[model samples]
Target: MLNMFNTALTALNANSTAIDVTGHNLANLNTSGYKAGTVSFEELVTQDLSVDSSDINGNGIGAPVLSRQFTNGTVQVTGGLLDAAISGNGFFTVQGSDGNTYYTRAGNFKLDDSGNLVTATGENVQGWMATNGVASPGGVPTNISIPPGSANAPVPSTFFGMNMNLNALGTVDGTNGTFTAPVEVVDSLGTKHTLTATFTKTDTNAWKYDISIDGGDVDGGTAGTPSSLATGTLTFDTNGKLTAPAADAGSVEISLPAFANGAGEQTVNWQLYDSAGASQVTQYGEASAVNSNSGDGSTAAQLTQVVMGDGGKVMAKYSNGTQKLVAVVALASIQNPDSLVAVGNNNYSTTPASGPVSYGEAGTGTRGGITANALESSNVDMARELTNIIIYQRSYQANARVITAGDEISQEILSLKR
Candidate 1:
């Protein structure tokens, strides 16, 4: 009778644990990246009723073992620029404050005050940061930083080009043939200056050009006066194509002295022809007008936004209409993900049974690709959990009834003896 009571008690404990596991699954049904756990019951030791007989007595059920389902959950598009999700098999590697490494599938990430990409609980996301818009992910990873309010360094003007037609029927050696085009350029200090190109029809099929800047822009220069920086002659053939300056030497060099604002002297290249040997400056009977002009220079710009890009790239946009790669998120793959122990916060730590972790960029090797602007929903199945709950409840009741029946039989035997 005592042995029967022990067996029923053990079964009751096992069923109770199974019920707890089901409840846990139901509780985290909405948790991001939460893997549902299933309860597995193992049979306890059985006793042989008789050495030569085939009859056997079942002892009871042992403790229930909870195993997590490592299958991927459905991806939910959150449309958040910083959010990310894994489409296949992989985990986002992160470093907790305790200086220990962990992995997670929750990618509802945000930038901390220090500009480090971090999880909701403030763990630093590990990856390779970019330098000068290039990301070079190596064997080791570091905290990915995309600093807010950052400034892109200004680039000084190196070259300028224009395509236009200089009137062929204009008066020679006078203002009537002169056409002035103003082009803006940036100095080393990011200061804007207008470089004026003046062309004069000095003779048939020939023209004189002068490229100048405001006198006040250079040291010891008089204010409001044009300081000539370059002078050259252009000769065109009968077909209206430039024939004097060789195609290889179609660019004039403009040398600027030290600026009043303490900017160093720099040389600018003025291109009259493109790389394909096509003349940018043409002598035609039409009115002289600059059709287009371009300069390779820009002022410092502020950071506009940081967003998740394809292939797990972190992209930063600037106010100057430029985008740069900030970093690439790292993904880790384990041979047996089920061997990983859940450390809470939707993170997992590796154990010996999990084998070694292989870290790499997403979509490489056994790693999975990343889905930007999304998050992974919990993998719990509500209907399945509810069904398990009902089954466990029934099992618990049945075990309790066995204990009650054993109590009644003991009372009956004692009463008969009395």
Candidate 2:
């Protein structure tokens, strides 16, 4: 009877552990990025009533959520520029204040005061530093600042490149031969300028040209006359990104306007009339600038008018007139991600069971990068947890009943003596 009581006691202990796991799951059911765990059981040792006893039952199984080590949850997208989600096997590394590395799946990152990109808790995000413009593994963990597009900085850009299609009149009046068309030029601030490319037909399919910009003689902007192409060569790419780099590109160095709002800013002043054309300058509206980029104070502005080249794309441009690319966020994958041990503070620590971290840029390989303005939700199933609760409660009660029955039998034995 005493041995039976011991067996019941062990069952109670196992059931109690299972109940604790259930409580944890219930508590974290609404947690963001939380993964629900499941319980598993292994049988305890069994007694054999035979001439020669055989070892059986080993360690008895109880309800266990520990077996549900990880969960694959659904992700929600918000479409914000800074929001990102990881679609495959990897962990985001964050450095805690304690100087230890912590991992996470949360991608809700923003720029903190120190200009470092950080999580909601201000844990710094990591990235590869660029060496000579080549991104490599040596980048120190640094914060990325939120960029607020400010005033157009003063920088000179020569005729960078321009793409345009022309309609030839086929036959030029030998007596009075001339043709006119518009060509675009971007200034130091990436403002576009329309230069009137002119051709005095020397022959069919060919013309000698002089350029007038914003209707002003751009030939005057440069000391020499605008050079004209005599032979064949004026094709455009589909999306408008140049198929070949634009050459000879003389450049125009336009100065910035002296206004905060830049309300009346123009890519350039231009008007091309068929010969008797009035000298008119072209300027963009307020909505164009606002929609084109975030302002200096980080205002949310919608881009209304989109400027396109041969194709349509408004790539990032910096103060130096150098192209700036929205940095591609990195992602890390693990062969056995479940092996990762969850540390507190919404982070995890890597264990050997998780294997090595495989690094790659987002949206590449089997791993995919997520858009901004989206987040991953918890994987806890309330119904499943409730079922676990019932099983644990019943098991606890059954174990307790076993002990009670054992005590009752003991009482009967004593009564027999009495």
Candidate 3:
């Protein structure tokens, strides 16, 4: 009779634990990146009924063990540039305020006042920084930040290439056949200057060219007046293809005077030949029109926006139409993620059973790729949890009935004394 009572009491305790676990799961159904907790009950050790008998019925129920379900949660789009989600297996490593490292699947990240990427609870996100628009792999991860009010310095114009048609039927003198092409170049100080190239037909199959800058003089030229920086002659074959001024001679080197604001002298290379060995300045039988012009330079620009890529790279877009890599978010993959210890705030700490952590860029090895502007939803299934609650409640009721019956039997036995 005592064994019966002990069995009922143990069963009730196990059932109670199951109810608590189910309640916990249901309560956190809406929690971001929350993995549901599951409970399992085992049979307690059995005892021998007698020395001569083989019967060994259990006397009590064993304790219930609680574990987390590591299954992936649904990913939801949040449309925030800094929001991120893992599409496969891995966790975003963050450093907590307590100076310990924790891993998480929740990607609701924000930029702190100091420009460091941090979780809602103020844990710093770790990543590699990019230098000069390029990121070097295999570096230790650190806090990723974007300096406020950052700006990209200007790049000076080094070369300019043009593709245009010079009228094939134009006059052979400066009287009726001259075309002026204006090209904009940037100096070391980010100042724009209009450099003009004048082409004059000298004779059949021949043309003379001169380059000048507006409001300035070429180096070694008369000051305060428009002066030619370079002069050369172009000759075309009977087939109307440029034949003279060989490829080596097709480029001109010119120097410009210092800017009023103390910028240093600028040197630019003017390319006349295209990659196809054809002169960009072709004397084809067509109207004198510029086809395309390209120059290598940029004015000063400010950082306007930052975006996260699928590969976990953060890129900064500038106002001058340039994009550069700012940092690469690192991910950690554990051999047994299910064994991680949950610390609060949707984070987990490494445990002895979790195995060694392997760190790498997302989408590489066992690490998962990143989905920007999104977050991972909780993995808890409300319907399943509700059903589990019903099952545990019924089991608890059955165990309670056993305790009630045991008490009534004990009372009946005690009544014999009356």
**Highest TM-score among the candidates is held by which one?**
3
lDDT of 1 by residue, 178-220 (tens): 8999998888988888889899888999999999988998999
lDDT of 2 by residue, 361-390 (tens): 555566655545566666777788898889
TM-score, candidate number 1: 0.81
User: Per-residue lDDT for 223 in model 3?
Assistant: 49
What's the true lDDT of residue 140 in model 3? 60
The list of candidate 2 runs beyond 4 A from truth reads: 46-51, 55-68, 129-134, 137-196, 202-204, 212-323, 363-372, 413-418
- For candidate 1, which ten residues in a row score worst on lDDT? 47-56
**TM per candidate:** 0.81, 0.62, 0.84
Ranking by TM-score: 3, 1, 2
User: How well is each residue in 271-382 modelled by candidate 3, as lDDT tens digits?
Assistant: 8797777688788877777899987888889988877777788888899898889998889889998788888898999889999887889988977789988888999999
Residue 57 displacement (Å), model 3: 2.8
Query: What lDDT does the true structure give each of the candidates?
Result: 0.88, 0.50, 0.84
**Steric collisions counted per model:** 0, 36, 0
The alpha-carbon deviation from the true structure for residue 181 of candidate 3, after best TM-score superposition, in angstroms, is 3.3
Q: Root-mean-square deviation of each candidate, in angstroms?
A: 4.0, 10.5, 3.5
- The TM-score obtained by model 2 is 0.62
